[model samples]
Structure formats: structure tokens, C-alpha cells
Target: MLKKVISKTIQLPDNRVITIETGKLATQANGSVLIRMGNTMLLAAVVAKEAPEEGGFSFLPLSVDYQEKFAASGKIPGGFLKREGRLGDHEVLIARLVDRAIRPLFPKRFNSEIQINISLISADETILPDALAALAASSALSVSSIPFNGPISEVRVARVNGTFLINPSPSLLEQADINLIVAASDSSILMVEGAMSEVGEADMIAAIRYAHDAIKLQCQVQKELMEAVGVEKTIGTTHHASAIVCYPIALREAIYADLYAVAKQHIPSKALRKEAFMAVSNRYREQLAKDQNGQEVTTTQQKEWLDELENQAIRALILNENVRLDGRLLDQIRPIESEIDYLPSAHGSALFTRGETQSLTTVTLGSKFDEQIIDRAMEDGYNRFMLHYNFPGFSTGEVKPNRGPSRREIGHGNLAMRALKAVLPPDKENLYTIRVVSDILESNGSSSMATVCAGSLALMDAGILVKAAVSGIAMGMITDPTTGRFAVLSDILGDEDRIGDMDFKVTGTYQGITACQMDMKVAGISYAMLEKALHQAKEGRLHILEKMAETIAAPRLDSKPHAPKIVTIEVEKEMIGAIIGPGGKVIQEIQKETFTNIDIAEQGYKGIVTIFAGNQEMLEKAVSRIKTITARPVMGEIYKGKVKSVLNYGAFVEFMPGKDGFLHVSEVRLERIENLEDVLEVGEELQVKLIGIEPKTGKYRLSRKVLLAPDVVAAGG
Candidate 1:
């Protein structure tokens, strides 16, 4: 009844197996596949519709959405909605990985609207499915009767204690130094995204190669299943170019010559070079309407092909002449100029300008009240460190209305955040909520990497003792599909990145790579070429780090004058009730009297106390009050205790906070007292020593006679 449940399984190098099955569910879609690994299961269903009825878009209309079902994790959804509403940042990010991997494999002219939806139907706590979501989505599209050039799969490569592990469990990831998610076709890597612990270039590259081996085998499994299913993949007829795209023979020839000439020309200013290239494109567009046939109804996409030709022209020059668009050596980085404390009022600020790209970054430190609250699927908590990146249209000389941050902005910001997070001072060492904002004032290429560089400086300027200065570089690669000759370009430009086959962003410090992202458009690149790129990236990264050092060598000795100061103390857990009285009255009163923030938490047998204030006076005031509340009564300690009440035989003395002791009438004086009223009265003061405690009752014994001179007690008797 279920079509026998066709399935194929591949054993991972780590001894874990992934089973992909079809024909049991969602058969109406163009393609559907269920991927299982260690009890984790994800369902990917892809459907395509013919071109939109009245389309405003000419390019491929593709959408990828990923959702995590709480039911799959054996948990009920939280919040008032009692169900998942919008996609969280993590889900959106996962969807982006899949979109980037498969978007390029589709035929350029396949304008049919396509949608891929992936859901985690069964979530295994031990096995993370975010990395596997991409693989499942691609497998679905691969086995379907769709003209996709992929049965690609992605693998998570983690280096734990110097050994590479594929698809490591959550617990094993705790020890990994290098982590990467690599998506690949049979022979070529399609997409790459990962973070590292500043491992060397060689290690990072080796990790990639290791990941591809697993990916290749998975691809083979999908191919076999596709063959066994015997589904005929669709083969769309090759669409011809429109008349407008078919530029005149004379004009096309002239444009090619012009582009080659332009690429060879030595232009230092990015704006001037961009103008030179656009001038040729404008001239060709002007000639398109000169024909009497009236092809003014040309789709925007057709005219865009002319731009593609320009890209090709640039690529040809890069491959043939080993010449970059900027006229720098293949390994040369653009000149970098950086300065700290650029903003007068910012807690910490820096402006980093690398050739054409610029970032004005600022850092702000606050108390726990400023921490960001997370309300997401997997976890809901607070974040003490946050980084935000912004790119305005005017930054790149574009004219468009500003709305909100695009997906690219969010993704880049997240990358930079992780790059610097590894080096931040631990919360216990310095407790302050941190926020870094990078505003792109000018951009040509690698603004995100520029953000990383600027963020490090800003943090140092704010006196944050980061482990080491962090720097980033974006590497570009141009390959000749014919002879397989490839050139890895360092510090690439906008034009080079547009034409290049790969944009590999590598970021870190002198130690190793902190983060990396690689996305390739070609079928595949060889290990030799990839290795060269990594080494070159390292050279560029080190060069940038040296430049950053010239601006700020290390964190300053002090925060700015206006920054808030934090003080912390620990106390016995039993004393917590005294600090936070009934109805939180004591803590509230302390805050009011000192104008400071007090946060308390119980950790096992001890309680953590944190005091945040803007001035020395307030900070000291809060610390003293909390100390008094948590201090314990010590033996033989003299206290000017007040007589709380007088009794027939003794007086009650109020001592250390929340502690009281009995001062016996006989002990009140050296000579025996005839009446208690004659020696002591309520609301009186006396210097007493805590000499002993009743073993059974736990009542402290106070002595005032021990402090009296011996002659005075003898004369009184």
C-alpha cells in the first residue's frame, strides 16, 4: 500500500548512517524525500509552477522555507500563541543555506516559480538537523523530475582534538576547534559556511576536503536512488536569447575589446574604474533601440545578459592575464587606514577604511538590564554581547528608499558577531552588556570583513581586553573551466567578486581562522587550488592584522570616564534571605539609597552579588550595605551593640545584621548586680565581645565586663 518504501542509506565516515527514503509521503509534489540520521528525521517537499500569470520578476522565482516543529522534539510550543508563528532567525539562516546551494544549479532560463519547504518532523536532541536540512532539500529536488543539476549533499565537519569528525553529535561538538558546513555536488563544492577557533589555513582547508569526501558519497547514494526510481527528469528546451540580448555583431565585438582594454588599464580609484566599465554597457544599451524592428518590449532579464557578458569579459582577463580589476598583484591587499576613538562621545569607536570600503563602528557597554532577550524555538534566554551591521543605499552610490535590514545584512552581521565573540573577555572577568554597531559609510567589497576589523578596534578602544586583535579578508577565485587553471585573488574588488567563481571570506587573528564562508559558482575546484586560496587568505589576513595593530596595539588600561563600573561579591546561600527581605524590600531599599543596580542569584551553596553603578560613591554605598547584610557574627569581635530590650536577669543586644545575643546581668559588670535595671536599660549602648555560644540553643553569649578595666570593677564592688 505504501509503494514498498524505497530507501537508500549511506554510512558516514564517523560510523553514523543517514537514510533517505521516498514514495511514502507527499507524492503529489514534484519531489519529496525524508532524510534520517540518528533518529532525527526531516521531510523536504519541492513543488514548481509555470511562470507567473502576470510576472513582475524575470529571474528564477525560488523560495526556501524551513520550520522546526516542537512536536518533533516531544515538546509543546511555548508563548500565548501555543503554536509556531513566524520563522526564527535560526530557521531563516538555515533556509538561506539551502537557497544559496540550489539556487545556482537551476537553469538560467527556468523561470518557473519553485518553492522548497523543509520541516523537521522528528528532532533528535543528540543530532542537530540544521546542517542536514540543506541536504534533504537538495535530495528532493534531485530525485524529482526537475531539471536541477544537483543531487548535492552537505556535511558538518568538526575537528575535535585535532581529528576530523563528520556529523559529530552535540556533546562531541563541545571539544571541536574547527566546524564547517559544506554543501557539494559530486565533484564540486556548492556552498560553505562555518566557524573556527583560529586554526591555521592548512587545517581549515583540510577540513573542507574531508567534508567533501562524505558529501560525494552521499551524492552517489542519491543518484543511485534516482536511477532505481526510474523517474525521467524534465529537460526543458534550450531557450534562445531575445533580439535585444543578441547584440549587434559589431557592437558585441567592440564591447569585448573595450572590456579587455579596461581590465588592463591601471585604475586606482574604484569609482573611476566602475564608470569606465559602465560607459561601455551604456553605449551598447543605446544601440539596442537603434534597430527599426522596435524590440523596446525587451524583458529586463534579456538586457541583463549584456551585464553578464561584461562579467565574462572581466573573468577572461583575470584568467588570461592574471590581472585583477584593481591592478594589484594577485596576493596584494589594498591599502588600509584605521583610527580609534573617531567619535567624540561614543564609549568606544573606530573608523576602518580599507581602500574603498569603510566602516564606522562603535561599542557600548551597559548593565544586565541592557541584555537582549531571546525568544526562539530551541532556547529562550538573554544575550550579553550583540553586534549589529547596517548598509545604506548611499554607501554604494545607489538611490533606493530605505526600509529594513535585508537578509544579507543580517547574515553578515551574524558572521562578524561570531568572529569576535571568541576573544571577548569572559562575563565573570568583566560583567557588562556589550553591543557593537558597524555602519558602512562606503563599500566596494568585503564590508562585512571590514566590520570585523572595525569591531575589534572599537572593542579595544572601549577598553575591552579581547584575547587578540581580530582581522578578516575576503578571497576571490577565478577558474578556467577548460584547462582548469585557477587564480586566487586576495583583497578582491566589486567587479572581481561579481565575475569570480568564488567568494571565500576568511576572518581571524594571527593565531588562526575564527570564521569562514565559501560559496562557489563553478562545478568544482581541485584540492590543490583550494589549498592555494587558503594560504593566500592567511597572508592577506595577517597583512590586515598588522595594519590594525598600527592603530591600536591592545586594549586600553581603563574604560571611558562616563562608563558604568561593576562590583561583585559572593555570600553564603543562607544569607540570601537577609539581603532580599520579604517582598524584596531590602534590595529595593538598597537600590533606592545608593542609586545602583543590584542583581542576586543563588548558585548551589553560595549566592552571587553584582553591583552596578555610575559613580564611585554609589558603588561603594551598595557594596557596604550588602556586606553588612551577609556578614556573619565572629567570636571575640567587639561591637557597639544596642540594647534591644531589658529582661529580669539579662539584656538582649542587637549585633551583626539579623543577629541578636543575650548579655546576662551578672556578666554585665565585674561585680554581681543587685538589680538588672541598675546595670542595663532598654535602648542603651555597650561594647560587647562575642565570647561563646550555647551549644544546644545556638544563642550567642555577649560579655561587657571583659572590656572594663580591672580597677574600676574592683572599686565598684
Candidate 2:
């Protein structure tokens, strides 16, 4: 078959062009598309099983994989296998971005195990593939025969020097104060995840709007591409894959009053509230059994009916009577308790509990050797600030094996890391490699936000000197599809998150937002609603911040007494080799003698030397030794030196830590010395003067005769 490729080009605000083409790759799949921007190319292919998997599923079984091949960047894999293993954190994050963008666009009952795979086939050093992955995924779905409500697109908008640029280059993005990845359809935003430099709400909104405009253009291109390909989405008949059982109005009416009363009770205990709801469900089940003359009812069907009833009852209580599960106002936050220095052995630790959710966070400081090495197809560097989140099954009162960090765990840790990174001291001032680990001890809802609060407090407790304290809150929205009425909830409960239309989390300092993540379940949510959510989240965040401040308002003036001390010094690049010496013998001797750790890195013409020591005395010793090594030699200056080795003709003396000078037998003493070893012991220390330096060999010449008395020298000769 002839491959007829159709292409559409989009000109960016910076005048760069991106092209989207179909029919050139993976045509046998349900849908496929290849998108190119600069030298980077991404291929997205989507396929769906004709029918739902056996045993059936009520929700969409969508799986998204975003992979970056090492070959794409003209490099090979690093590990022994020489093949890509499981996705790295960076790759997982991009896949999550694409998943969050297009997950809501599919039909609600489309449970056909749909899989979207995107590959970075070719890469450019400057262009990031995150937003393009989403766009290509959406375009592939648009050209497929499957039913979808989207031709959505995503753009990474950054504000550099007070101007917003759409999908800026990597270098340009580094300079941006406000960086966001926004996913949107032609009309409304579907997902948002990014970090900023404590940017205000208004500025964030402006960035999102700016990105939406660019997203609109990309979405339009997908539409035109679909039309050109003559592929119209097949409006298949809606099939209830699980054979959903809808209860009668009489049954719902029977349970409505009781369910509403239970929901209105405002039970603060999650376990109690859950039990009460279950009691109500059991009553409904018994009534249904009697109504059907005691016929056996499928457990799944009965549970589904009861779930729907509960959703309706809780939503109505909130929307009609302004009553929440916990009796808090729509903008009210849960009670927060925070404490710092909770662990004696840890460098820094904090216990943050907000309502039922809690995070025990700890901070550790190390030298540059502790920094994490990131080696990927497109990006290679060291990450000094790391945050690891762990959610044990016991935290949620469940029994499950611990297999390691899940995708959700990684995503949550990343969001918290971004939030706290904004307040960390600049690289120059903060020299230690920092790691923040949050362990969930209890979870009800918004545990990631709790991690943020605890991590901030722990950092302060560790004397990190953060620019400002950061706090986070989760916001939920419940919308009346028919009436267009919506309620924005602050610090929502787990149930609200499952039943709500949106799960929006905002994190920031007192001045502005630092990081945020939003996922929308419903379509066409107006900007007004989002604005309201942001404002409400801000209030909640401030409340949490006030509570956190009660524990520790600012970073501690000094780190713990047991913590390691770091000192940095800069010297000329020429001095680096002198300090390291041949085969690293000099520096190794210094570290072994001083009992300290040292690292050296070159920047331009200067070398940055960092020393980590146990105490001030050790730090001083290391610093002084490095100074002596890099110190320049002066002519005609007498200095105390140690004899490193002895030879027949002469002996080499170490004038400095790594600087050695040749001392001849004639210069050893005023008298004639026959045996150099006997005259000058190998490990002896003596006074020597810098007489001259041989320019040809760049060797220093020292004289002991110059320091001897004039009469005594002549008599000895």
C-alpha cells in the first residue's frame, strides 16, 4: 500500500516551526502520527482492544507509555545490559503528563483497554519532548476510528524577562521565573503541572492563558489533519461492559433520606463515616431483596448501585445544603499539627499531621559526592536536591507487599521537591547535597501536600537557610452538570477526591505559588471556576503556613552539632594539579591525615575545592593544607620544609603540601656531607631558603647554606 503522508505546520511565537504528519509510521495500529520540531521527532501510536477485557471494568483501562530511546540522542545505554530497562523518573514523569492530559477526553464507558505508546525517535539537545508527547498522542487518537472528544494539545509556557514564550528552548527555560506545562482542548484546560519562582496567582493564570492560545493552534491542526485523512471517529453504540445495573427510582427514594442524614451528620472519623455508609448500603440491599421476593442479587451490581446512591447523596448534601463530610466550610481547612526536631539522630526531621493524613519527613545533608547522577537519552547532569516519598500499605490500613516506589509515589515526590526547591538557597550559598524523604505514616487525603509542609519544616530544622517556608493544600471541585453550580473544597477528603470533578493541588510560600498540579475530570470548565479554585487554595495554603510557622518560622541559625561542616575555596586552575599531585598521592595523604572529604571541580579558569569535615578544627586543617598547596613560592624566603626522600646527589623536600623542591648536597649544610641519608634523615624537618628556580624544568632550588651562620659555614666547609 502506498503511504500518503499528510502534514501540517505550526509556527511558534518565536517563529520556529513544528510539523505534524500522519501515514508515515506505524500505520497498522488504530492510529499513528509523527511530530517534528527542530531536529526532535516523536512517534505516537494508539491501539484499543475491540472489546473489554474479561471480567469487565467500569472505568477506562487506559495505559500510556512514553519512552526515550538512547539511540535517539546518538548515545548508547550505560548499564551492562546495553538496553533500556524500566522507565526512569524523567520518562515516567513525561508519561504521566501525557496520561493526565488525554485520560479525561475518552468516553466514560470506553473500557476497551486502550494503550497509547509514544517514542522519542529523534532528539534535539534544546527541545524537550514532554509537551510534544501529549500533542502527538492526541493527534494519533484524532486520526483513529475510535471515539474521542479531543484533539487536545499541550504547550510548555515559560516567562523569561517578563515575557511569556511558548515552548521555549531548554536554555531559555532555565532563565524563566514562571514555568508551566499546560494541556488543553480548543476551549478549556484539562491538566496543569509545573513550578515557578513564587509567582503570583494572576501571573500564573496569565501564563496558562498564554499556553492555551498556543494549544488552540495545535488542536486546530489535529482537526485539519483528521479531516484530510478522511478519518471520522466511529460513533459506536455505548455498551455497558460490566452490565451496569441501574436501580429503580423507588429504591433510590427509599435510601435517599437515610443516606442524606448520614452524610449530613458530619462524622469526622473516616472509619466511622465509612461504617455508617456501609450500614445504609446494607439496609438498601435488604430492602431490595425483599422487594424482589428474596432473589439472589449479584454483589458487584448491588455495590455499584449503592455507590451511585452514595455519590448522589454526598454531592447533593454539599451542593444543596453546603454540608461537607467533615462539616468544614467550602474554603475551610482541616486542623493541622506540626512539630520539628522529632528525631534525635536525624540531621533534621518533622512530623506534619493535617487531620488524618500525616507525613514524617526527614532531611539529610551531604557533600557533592552524594548528589544523584541523572543520565538519560536527552539530559545528563547531577541533581543536588532530591525528594523521595514512600507510602507504606500500613499508612492506609492495608496489608500489601512493598515493591518500591510506584508511579504515584514518584509523581508526588516530584511535586513536593519542586515546591521546596524554590525556597532553597542558591547553589553558591548552599553547598551541601540535600535529600528530603517523606514517609507517610497515616493517609486520608492529600498526603503529598503534607509531605510538602513537613519537608519545609525539616529543612528549616536542619539549618538549610531556606529563603522562605513553603506550604501546600489540595482543592477539590464538585459541579452540577445540569445546573452549572460548583463548590470549591479546601483540603478535601479522600471520598471527595474520588467523587469530585477536579483534584487540584497548590503549593507555595507566603508571597506566591511555587508549584501546582491540576487534573480535571469534566470538560469545558471555565477559567472563572479555576480562578476561584486558585484563590481558595491560596487561603488554605496560608492557614497551613501559619500552623507550620508555630513549629519553626525560619531556618535555624546553625546546623546540629553532630552535622558535618563544609567549607569551599576557589583557586587558580593551575593550582589544581599541584593539589592533586601524581596518582592522587598528595590529596590522599591530606585526607587521611586530616580525616576529611574533599572534592574539586573546574569552572572556567578557576577550580572550586570543597571540603567536608567533622568539626571546625578539621575543616580549618583541610582549608589550610589546600591553601599551602596552592600557595605560590617566593624567592629568598626561608621556610620550614620536610625531607620526603633522599638520593646520592640531592634530596627532595616538600616545601608545601604538594609542592616539592630539590635540595642539593651542597645546599644541605655549610660542611661537606658525604652520606645524604646520614646527614639529612629522610623524614627530618629543616630550614631552607628559596634561592632560585630553574626556568627550563620549572623546578625550585632551595639553599640551607644561606640560613647558616657566615663564620660557621666557612669553618664547616
Candidate 3:
């Protein structure tokens, strides 16, 4: 046995070098690669099994898994088990990044089950592993003998101070106005996901082009690595993986006329149009069998050809006829309707329906306890805002068992969150935690965009002072590579999405874009085409926003009367423990007596306190109590207190939260008393004034006569 190691290095714009090597650890896998940048290291391995099992699925079964080891960041796993648990949100999101980049590159009919596993072996917080994971997975596929037309790579471009930096550090990301992730092959851009602080479209395209150059270089490196390793992707040919996939051209031609007519019919119901197309196809198949014309083709081949014809017909109609399946023009958007306060008990709710898609969205405002705490290797914090999306089978007119939210739901929810997050007020202005949930009631296309529309209305209805309203549009593209013509379709339908080359979802306000995602099923689109799509999307978004304004123009002036009010106050940080008291005695008494909720945070020099109550009366009462707890008695100031103890010549009176002042027998009352206990009992209340204080002893001298008449005090009455 012999072990050989070879590595390839690429230089980044910042003069930093990254290296990827094969023949390292996990060499026994089909293909293995370890990528390193600075102290961060990731190992990716891929294995494919041809025709492993027949589960009656036509598409490739690709399983991508990304895992992070706590030890990689020099920390032990959290929780009682002290081991890695289920897949985290970041892991799922990153796995999707890798899957989207490589899934489309597999040979058209290659249906093998491929598993790509990427693990974080070593890492530093500075170098992000998410972008590298995609490169490693693609590099492994490239060097393996698996049949793929890819050597794709993904990069994260972050704009800081108007300059785009590739894969910026954690601290740098904080300063970035735009954080964009791009996955691409040498010649094409495959996937894109990004969030911006209201960045413009031109700037976004420039960042993409910048990322395009870096992706091309990485793809070249992968090709060189594959050449050096002498690995050729002939798995499909060797295993007969796609050997039987042939669409009969004659059958396609026979069905083209009817399919084109059906595509142009503009049927309002998607199901009806789909059924009509199927019926026509069945009739044609019977005619062909009777004539013994296409009987030689297998049923699979016939079905495949029919589907191709449908896709081709739809594309041709859009490109040549300048019409969509729904009969709208290229730049036209579907009809939209929106309503708010649809749910009585919800903090806020809205229903937004566009064409056939509908979303029922609700907003819930919570407290600090509701914020989500994330614990991961490199990223650990609390997220104050969260958005959840759900889609059921019935939404699309199907009868399937409901399991749970799929990865698509999470990804869609994340996009909506990004779109709405930009409009949220600063944390200080809005202290309540916000959660937005969008449930799809009907689905024809772009339910995620519908969610965005509904979420904005829900936020406003909930009395959240968002900076601006946000809307979204899903744009589709029909490209004719040979003819050099393309049509950018706005508000695309599900059918168009299935056959179209691009699914570009843009979300924002009228001024600029907040978040966007574009996944390409075809080769790279030029910047000009992207610009056209963006402008079209903007137009569609504005149209949708105009419709939304009719329902609710802005956030309500006040939250629901039932909603609790939160009043925040700051006290000296050193007084926090005392306010809490020993064993939580003092604060508990105040809460029980005042019937209010209190939350505290220890800031630098002060303790931030928030009081939650049902009404203004309770809120003011709680505030007064807290002020008493933090208030200090000043010399020559009058105070009303309770006598906690009686001494031989003096009494100890409790004034502030825990402060006590000594009242001498001479200052016990306006008249002279023989004994202190005779005039002052242990449980009596009195009004006193601080006369003097011993600085060193920190003791107070109080006189009750100050609050009484001066003549009465002189006469000893």
C-alpha cells in the first residue's frame, strides 16, 4: 500500500492563499478532499452507488450532509449528552448550498444515489466554512469518477465600506452592507443568496460579477486537479446510468401543436390545464399505437417525450408569442389582494393572496425570554426576530400525508425573514421579541413571496414601527441559447418555474433591495439579462406594494389594548444585586405586591430594567416602587418610612428599598418624651427629615420636628 498527497493552492484578492488536497484522510472513499484556509479545515467525501435500489423515483437521489464538531473550535458539545445532536439550522442551510450547486450538473438522466458528507475537522472563527463546503463537495465530485459536468465552487462576497471582500471575517461581516453567497461553475452562475442593507440592483450585479471571476478561477483549479489525478467522469457510460433516456422526436413533433395550443389557452385553473394536456397526450399515444408508428418506444420514453414537448411548447410560446401560460405579458404581474387583522386573538395577522397563491401570516410579540439562543462552533447568539413558513399538500391540491416542514420551508422562511428584517426598528426602539409565521393556504407559485407580503402587513398591524413596507416577486426566464433571445417573466407560475431556466426571487421596498435569491437551471446569464430581470422584478414588487397600501398604510399608532406594556428604566449596575435582594427577596415582594413582571440586564455602568404590566396604572405603580428601591436619601430631605426597631435613645427607620436612618429620642417627635419606646412603637410609621450625616460612619441624623410646626416644637407640645 502507498499513500501520496497532492495539493493545489489558489490566491485570493486579499493576498491570502487557500489550499485543497486529495490523497489525505478518508482516502478510501470514492473521492476525498480536505480544504484549508488559515487555520480552518474541512474534509469532504463523496460516494455514488449506481441503481442502488428502485423506489420508483425518476430523479437523482442525492443526499448531502454537513456537520460541525465542537472540538474543531476547541470546545466541548453542549447539553447533557455532550455530543452532536440533530442537524442544526446552519448545517441544513449549508447543505442546501452544496446541493443546489451540484444537483443540476449531473448528466440529464443519471439517477444514481450520491451521498456527499462534509465535516469540519478544524476551524477558526475568521474563515467561514459554509462557502468552502460547497467547493470541497464539488471538488470531490470532480475528482471522483462520477459523471458530472461540473467543478463548481461557491464564494461569499461581503461589501465593507463600499468594497467587496471575498469571505470576510465575523467582525468584518458586521460592517458589511451586503453579504452575498454565490455558487457557480467555470462558465455559469448556478445559485445565489444574499442580504443587503437596502442596496441597489446595479451594486448587487457588480458584486456578482466580482464573484464570477473568483468562481471561474476555482473551477479551473478543480479541472487541473482532475487532470493531474487522471480521473474521467464516465460512470454513466460504464454503468449504463442514462443509456435508455431518449425522447422520440417524432412523438414530440406529433404533440407539439396541441401542447402549444394548450399552453396558449390561459386556463385560469392549473389543474384543469394540466388534465387537458394529459388527455390530449393520452389520445395521441393511442393513435400512435394503432398506427404502430411509435410502438417501439418504451412507456418511459413516451412520458419523457411528452414532458419535453410540454416544456418546449411553453418556452416557445413565451419567447415567440410574447405570452405567458396565464396570458399575461412579460412584465405583467398576477392580481393581488391583501387584508389585515384577520385573526382576532393574534397580536397581528394578515392574508395576502396573489393570483392562485395565498398566505395567512401572523405576528407574535414576546419578551426577552422568547428570543432564540443559538449555540454553534463559530456562531453563538440570540436572534430576536424569527420567521416560520409552512406548506401543506392541500395547498397545491394534492393528497399526501403531512410530515413536517421540509428544507424548502426553512429556506423560504429564511428569505422572508431577511426581506422583512431590514425594515425592523433598532432593538432599543423596539424591545419586544418578534416572530412572524406564514402558512400557505393555496399554492400556485411563489408562496415565499406571498409570505413576505403578508408578513409586512402583519408587522404593521401588530403596531411594529417598521421603517418601510416590503414586497417580493419571483421572476422566471425563458432563454433560447441558439436563437439568442430570452424573456423575463414576472410573477411566474409553478409550471413556468418547473420549465424555466431561472427562479429569481427579489424582496424589498421601493428604494432598494433587502434580500434576494436566484437559482439558475441553465448556463450563466449575462449581466444585462440580470439587470432586466431585476428591474422587472422591481416593477412587480412596486405593483404589489400599491395593492398592500390599500389595506393598511402604516403601523397602528398603538398596540392592541390587551397587549402588555413594557417600561424600561436604568439603575446603577452596582445596585442590581441589592435590588434583587438576598435570595431574590426584594424584587419578588415588589412583583407580588404590584402584580407586574420585571426583567433586568446588567449593562456596563447601569442595570437595564424592563417592567411589564397590563395597564398604565400597574405600570406607574411598578415604576414608583422601583424608583423607591433605587432612590438615595439626601441630607435635609424629608422622608416617610416605617420603624423597624426601637433603641434605648433612638429608632431605626427604613426609608428607601433597604436603607435605614437613625432617629434620636430628641428628634422622635415635636415634644420631648421620657422614653423612646413610649412614643415610637416597633411597627409605627412616621414622617421624618434628615438633619445631618457623619461622612465616615455613613450614618444619618433625622428629626421628626422638622416636618411639624416650629412653634409646637419650641413649646414642646
Index of the highest-TM-score prediction: 3
Q: Write the per-residue lDDT of candidate 2 for residues 621-656, one digit (tens) a residue.
A: 999999988888999887899999999989999876
- Deviation (Å) of 281 in candidate 1: 3.8
| Deviation of model 3 at 443, angstroms | 0.9
lDDT of 3 by residue, 56-103 (tens): 346678899999989999988778999999888778888988887778
Residue lDDT tens for model 1, 1-717:
547568999999757889999988899899999999987999999988733435434567789999988888777777798898877767877888888888888865666678999999887878989879888988899778778888788889999988999988889998898888888888887878888887888788788889999988988999888887887867342343442345467866787898778878868887898789878767667666443454453545445666677778888887887777778888999999999999978889999999999999999988898888875545558999999899998899998687777778878898899899878888888798999999999999999999999999999999998999999999999887788788899988877788788888989989998998887766666778778888899899999999999999999988887777787899999888999988999899999999999999998989999889987778888999999988878888888899998888899998776679999887888887888887777888788889899889889999888878577558761
After superposing all C-alphas onto the true structure, candidate 3 shows an RMSD in angstroms of 2.6
The estimated TM-scores of all candidates read: 0.91, 0.92, 0.94
Q: Please list the C-alpha lDDT of all candidates, in the order they appear.
A: 0.84, 0.90, 0.86
Q: Clashing residue pairs, candidate 2?
A: none
What C-alpha lDDT, on a 0 to 100 scale, does residue 305 get in candidate 1?
64
**Candidate 2 off by > 4 Å:** 232-248, 290-296, 614-617, 632-638, 643-682, 688-717
- Comparison by TM-score, 1 against 2, better one: 2
Clashing pairs in 1: 188-524, 198-512, 198-513
Deviation from native of the Cα of residue 713 in model 1, angstroms:
11
The total number of steric clashes, by the backbone 3 Å criterion, in model 3 comes to 0
Prediction RMSDs, each to the true structure: 3.2, 3.3, 2.6
